[model samples]
Target chain A: MARIEINQSLCKGCALCTLLCPEELIKIGNQINENGYFYAVFTENGSCKGCALCAKICPDVAIEVWK
Target chain B: MSEKKIFSRPKTLKDAPFHFCPGCHHGIAHRMVAEAIDKYSLREKTIGVASVGCSVFLYDYFDVDVIEAPHGRAAAVATGVKRARKDKIVFSYQGDGDLASIGIAETVHTANRGENITIIFINNTVYGMTGGQLAPTTLLGQKTTTSPYGRDFMQDGYPIRMTEILATLEGTAFAARVAFTTPKNINMAKKAIEKAFQFQKEEMGFTFVEILSACPTNWGLNSIDSMKRVEEEMIPYFPLGIFKERKAADVL
Candidate 1:
């Protein structure tokens, strides 16, 4: 099993993570974070492969992945 | 089953969050350098020469010892530091405006003199910190704050390909141009950066890596579109590849 955690406060809502996640488990939420950006959030689906593509593409370095 | 962490922030990076603009490539570039330093166990002896511009605060982001240099003089300062302390791994993180414009003479001379140092050049095509001014690497017909009518070849000479130019110098041991818009490209870029550092560790001559980065805010594009620009617009002008890799045997 694999999972990912995104530090919402550190995210700047670039959406690069949402685009790079091969499993498509990450998304930009409607509500903005403390930084006034829509921050990325994991959908928590059981399909995440923990490839860390999202973490790699993320300019904010806000994602942490575990498997 | 026990959980294992697959990915996290690099140890070389400080706990403070980055102050770069949203979607900036500086963050990714920083991570690449930090990871390379960690892999080589050079964190303790690395000295980073921070250049002026958007990345001026590199001292704050990277945990390694960093010295701020005057505008466009990072390569010159790095030369002094490396000469004074040969045991330290010295590097200079510079932007297009810093490396290709005012600092061009120093950059060329440093590499030509065979200084054993690493240079991380970020070519985002515009002066990001100065509100989108025309840079030496700016593409033809690309509009900037100063070049409102698009960059005319006659008015502003052609874009300078620093990597290719430096690769021609005998002193340069490694020179490559890379972009991290995709996972495959990012992987390649990481390898190239690590190789640059590795070459330096082996006491090879000057090493250089020019990264085609994005300036979303300055380019008037959104984050995703700016990254796409790096792929479609920038890569065409500045092809990605290892232009030169000199073997120590060749020098002998």
Candidate 2:
């Protein structure tokens, strides 16, 4: 199974990926990053399926989803 | 290279009773945007920011979700909406006064941040909403309410070339100025707009489309006269074409 990793510092908490993902795989995490902004991280159900849905939904062009 | 002429424009535009005056370039610009969204299949996901000045009614014009911002705040509002809903294609429609004058700060910062959004700036030289007062892009020696005689360079300074100004910023990924002066120029503007949108889809950076539109009523010129002015006068001051372009290689 493929997983997702977010460069927390790069994430701007747009939540676009979290919203557009057909599967509830990504979400805003409780912790903040170096930028002091809330970042999305992986969880138990975090298998991304490599659909690139996360990448497609990012506005700042921040997310990079790989298989 | 030869390109394909896309299909006809959206039917929504065909609806009669257009609020705009005859020969106003806003009509063409609006269709261009809708055509681009249709070609890219972004209709359902696109959200537009309606700006101040004459184009404020953009919300009613476009067949998409539109949000309004205070004069010159469209970029910042668009940034927020785009950030919150990343899947949606976001763009801001602004006039010269709105974009180049009151909103210069937002415009510069948004381009610097490369927020993956499109800015459609209409530079018609004069402010259409409040009266034909001189705009930031108002041509030198052009008469306006503020400059009753003409825009004296000594007092008012020269017209701002927005695309040129934005192109100098390192954060700007794509910046181009286009005009709706003639059929030939319209085609060029279409290609430039396509390229601007493509940059965002490819995750390059920010994109701006500066259109030298015509404000016939505010300009104190009839349709033909304004069109001629756009072709003969405005083009000289605000020439068209891509000012800056960067491929993925340049970024990484």
DockQ of each: 0.90, 0.01
Q: Which is the leading candidate under lDDT?
A: 1
Query: Which lDDT values do the candidates have, in the order given?
Result: 0.93, 0.76
Residue B136 shift from truth in candidate 1, angstroms: 0.9
Q: Compare the candidates by TM-score and give the number of the best one.
A: 1
Top candidate (DockQ): 1
CA lDDT of A53 in candidate 1? 91
Q: What RMSD value applies to candidate 1?
A: 0.8
- Once superposed on the true structure, which residue ranges of model 1 sit more than 4 Å away at CA? none
lDDT by residue (tens digit), candidate 2, B1-252: 432322233633333323555446776677777668777877778899999977888777678899999999999999999889988889999999999999999999998888889999988999888988888888988888999999988888888899998998887888888875544666788798888777777778788989888777788886557767987998877778889998789988
- Report the Cα lDDT for candidate 1: 0.93
Looking at model 1, residue B60 earns an lDDT score of 91
